[model samples]
Target: MTSDTEEQEDELLALHSIFGSDEFVRDESKSAGELRVCVELPAAFMVALTEGETLSQYEISFLPPLLLTFELPEDYPSSSPPSFTLTCSWLTHTQLSALSAQLTDLYQATGGAVVLFSWAQFLKEDALRFLDIDTLLELPSGEHSTQNCSQDSLDVALSEAKNNKHTPATGPTDIQSLDLSALSLEAEQTLQTSEIKADYQDDQSKQISKEDFLNEGSVLLPSSSSGPLDESEQGAASLPRESPPNEDQRLSGRSLTPSQALLSQILIYDAAQQQKQFATTVFDCGVCFMGLLGMDCVQLLCGHIFCRTCLSQFCKLQITEGNVQGVTCPDADCDAAPTPAQVRSLVGEELFSRYDRLLLQKTLDCMPDVVYCPRHSCGSAVIWDKSSTAAMCTVCAFAFCVTCKKTYHGTEACQKKKKKIMTENDAEQPTAAVPRSQEGMKALWDDYVSGSKQRKRLLESIYGRRSLQNGLVECLSEEWVATNSENCPYCYSSIQKDGGCNVMRCYWCKRLFCWSCFAKLPSQGYLDHFDNGTCNHFGSDFFPAT
Candidate 1:
């Protein structure tokens, strides 16, 4: 008994080895030693309804994997059967129930032998065939029709098996009796009617074939037939007709019948499948550590596979950071770069536009003769030609000198304009005519006092005394304006007396400014600037007198 148990355990382990550990799970909750296995049905066995067509490759590959939970009994193979449950989300409850019942029937038919592996294989390869499911949408609505059709198919299969004489007679009987009681009376009647029709058609086919062979000599002369051959006879006669003169048919020198066309399509499909199998391979992405199919991954020239998602995200990060040239392979040691097509395919259209723009800008930056428009708001590229020192922006139509980077001066060399500006600036500078001393300082003060009295009288003659006094006060305040008062850096409004702390906000511009240096503060409120060295007066009063 112990040897038998060990053998059963060994068989279960061997099944696990064949399927892989990823597909099998050992359940500890069941003290009886249960195993949970997941199985993905083959693409050919799965079906779906899409766009009014019943022949779609089901989207089961995208759905959750099917799970089979089963427990082994102590004397499983010899006397006791395994206990199991099948779970799937893609199928409806009724479909699952039907499948579960059929699975149980399959196990019972094999008696007390080990049937877990057989059950798994059946569900993976033949579950849809056994369930009479052509498409997932047909499951719920065509239950009655499916029952009748499946019964007819079963009868047909049994008939073929019997005619072959190699199949065991009892096998057909066992299958026929397994679930016949579950079928409704109407379904059974329909199945019988279909069988009778099939038999009549077979007889008619044999009779027609015999008649065609006997009348072959007469058919050679078209005048033998009375009126016109039937549709089937006309089709058969057309097979020997001259081939169409089209280039495609002329290559083979023969026209293909429906059967031949279907066969060629099958051959082409098989070739495509072979190519697909050879091309695709699996690999784990270096960045995200996710398993991805070869088609869904982008392999760098350095031979590292990065999943499309991670590669796109990396490219997007680099492009958004204005590092278009730095969008290379993610590996630190590798310097391989993605091609423009690869980058365009990975990142979407909007981000690719930014990438393209930056790439063009970088290319222009390396050229010595290319300069952008001098306008601050419109910085389109402007190409300088040898004919002229100025370049006109194609986008904004702004013409500028390539040498001085300023508005174009007609027919004047940039060097001459620059020299003239330098000479005029030198002439405007104040000069020290004598040596510096107290006497020179007194002489300057006396000249300033007389100049200011004359300016006050001139201002009073031009305006009124009140306006003159206000202007004079403003001018006097200008001497200590930097130390005593500050202007709002944003709008340059003079802030004479602030009521709040050193971190003052401009009422006119509604922007934060530091009272000490009158520099603008961030919009995130007042306290952030003090910590960042932008403003030093964190706790000081707004207007501390000098």
Candidate 2:
């Protein structure tokens, strides 16, 4: 026959083989070990919390494991059962106690046999159903685990005190009587003196009544209160009361219950488990058409999976080519895009920065009330004011008009510089002869350039690409003339200075003016006008002395 030690060793070896090292650990010195049992949850198991009329529910796929620490005696399965302790975070003390008692009963029913595996199986597969937590588990509100722990400690202390036969039992009333009987006359006298001093220090509204003093004195020394204490007590009968909790405090008092706080931990564990499972699972990449573990794959918003290498290269190509809109899922039918964090992870910092800039520009371009600062080097986004014609770039501090895109001229009309190709034709026609419809179309084109993406699309749909190109050409031509030439102050005609003196003559109006000051000058004595304090004869920017 095999000895008890041999039987115990054989049982432990069998458990180790069944559970593997991850779930079971054995001590070589003695018949002892620990087992971690993860309770299997049903597919639709839900956890719910209710506050007033609002009910919130969540489905959890994972929970923290229950720990079972056990130590076996020399008698082992031949006589006594294995001594074990089962512990879990989500279960109450009463529930754990019930499960512990059931485990002991299972041992007794086994009639002297190894029951460790049976206990483990019961905890893993049947604990929830046995506890009658079938589909939904309702968590308690307004109850803290600390309060329960403190209460349990108090109960244990009371039980120990009760079991001590040497000490006499004392109720609260009896204890108070004993204390009163033990007090001396000197302590009473000192207490009365302290009360008198407190009366003087406190506010007048809080003054103590003679009855209150005498009544307290009577409680201490009953012999002194036989005379007029009854009449004084009747005269001042008000008592202090507790202040009520305010509305805000009352509402926020239950903001985080014990169960709700624990639910956050539970959800976190569930997420970690899900991620671990995903990392180990194999997935087929949609783009590369290769089988790979989830750790090497990227999952897009549309639930399509692709190898990280393929997705990273795709994003890099799009960002490098300045096609930010095309940096989305490669699925032809889907338009799902990667999140900014995912983009950052897939691509390095330099490429991500480009992607971020292009994305921001595209987003800003779609807004009707947003425009870019016209400075080529400092092209920062500026919020356009619809009511005002001028906008100030917060970045570079350049104040320019929204209409003419030139320096802001408050309450002044925009300087509309016609294209060089149109100047000759425009000069042949009268000012009033220019079509109002054409003027309106020009205004519309200006608006379309700075308007929202929807407005641009609508305009394009109505006028077609040819009209847009013509408007763009006109805008570019005007912008070029505005940058390269100055207006001839008299006729308001654009004039380029190709190495000349300060005195200028308008080609259309024949009016000579000081180019530096735009001041009209006498045709014969134009040189004298350059001697003014603001103008120089040699076309230098430096002004002459007055």
Candidate 3:
């Protein structure tokens, strides 16, 4: 749409502007080109930089200046906005920050020209702001824009941008060597910047880095210096704080290796051997976000992860409550089959002890595929130990004296004692009814197999309905939260954000108050001073908003 002459003219004009502009200086490099600019910041604002700790949100980059041609209006007003593009230099968190604020300032300045800001050193003598030095030759592990090599990446990038100023490699140096002339000059410049910040701040108390001001662990709580600020107590005078979770989860390959395979073999081991690390690896249950105490956590049929306590609790509680159809992944989201094999391996024989053989047979036969044991050591695992009058532990093979209900614990009379105990067991076991019980189990199996889909669909339907219910959503509300505060309006009381929104009960007075203003007495709840402007107490009829 445009003519070639217009483009060429624009390009040449931009070049002229760069060469003639006093505010920016251009550096030439074999690999790249760069433009440089620097600005001094007030200390208070610098401190606020730290408070903006959402790593993803803002970047304080220490990057090289950009290099691009900008076409200027012949009648450029000193107050008119300036335009430029960012390029060159790797992104150091600090540099991008300087550039952003500076660019914004320049564009907003009266007749966008060089705002001659001066530092004591730079104004008296034109000085370079950076040095070609590499500190700490560690790998760049955080999310980087480029997958560049680690050795002197930033400084080297700068050097390359300035046209490949190669300083021959001197093997990695000690900290002492870091203060040498080339590096020290930059360090000195850095020191000057720090001093400038401190000088401007004068008030250390008011100048804490924004990041420091925010205690990552201090949930919406009052500052420590302020006093007995419990995270719970909320008031009108205090501001509510909302922050994001720490992204500490790292990226690591989890392929099953030879070592892991070897470990798997030893998992079912109960034989007499030297004590080894019982729990060497921990896998969070794929289903539930519970802390699996041991390394043996696994996903059964549904691949939901759970700790022994959580998984066992869910399975027992649900099944007992007559939700056998729903005795699956305790995780509200998962509906996978609970693999019985995985459960047995973790618990060994503990799961079997939950019921006598009769109840177990019925349950297992009914939910053959939907069995799970909440043992960290045997997550999504199963153990195989067949028992007659006497049977060897499939894992340990230590010949348990089942008659005596012991293993390797039998003496010469152990076999005799086992024989006598099992003799009673044999009688107690339904020998005559074995055929009938087995037939009944067969019939039960047939019936279930015939209606498997229907049963499963019905169970899933009920579960989905319950979870999506309004009450469940209300129970998981996340908005009604406040931090701890030192000063309470109602006497000497401290508090933390327990739950709910916009309303809080003073533990001491049992009276509620406006979560925002503790100064105002609560006119609501159990002691509703409705006459005094508070609301009524908590009631089942009360349904929280979605």
- Per-residue lDDT tens digits for candidate 1, residues 141-242, read 121111111123447546753555332342211111111111321233212112110000111101111123222211121011211123343331111111
Total clashing residue pairs per candidate? 0, 0, 58
Q: Write the per-residue lDDT of candidate 3 for residues 71-173, one digit (tens) a residue.
A: 2333222332222333222233344334333443443443433322221123212322321113211112232121011112245434444553222243111
How high is each candidate's TM-score? 0.31, 0.56, 0.20
Ranking by lDDT: 2, 1, 3
RMSD of 2: 24.8
Stretches of model 2 off by over 4 angstroms after superposition? 52-54, 144-257, 418-546
Residue-level lDDT tens digits of model 2 in 223-307: 1111111224433111111111111111123433344544544554555555667678899988879999988987776788889
C-alpha-based local distance difference test score of model 1: 0.50
Local accuracy by lDDT, each model = 0.50, 0.60, 0.32
Best by TM-score: 2
Model 2 — which ten-residue stretch has the worst lDDT?
Answer: 190-199
Reference-based TM-score, model 3: 0.20
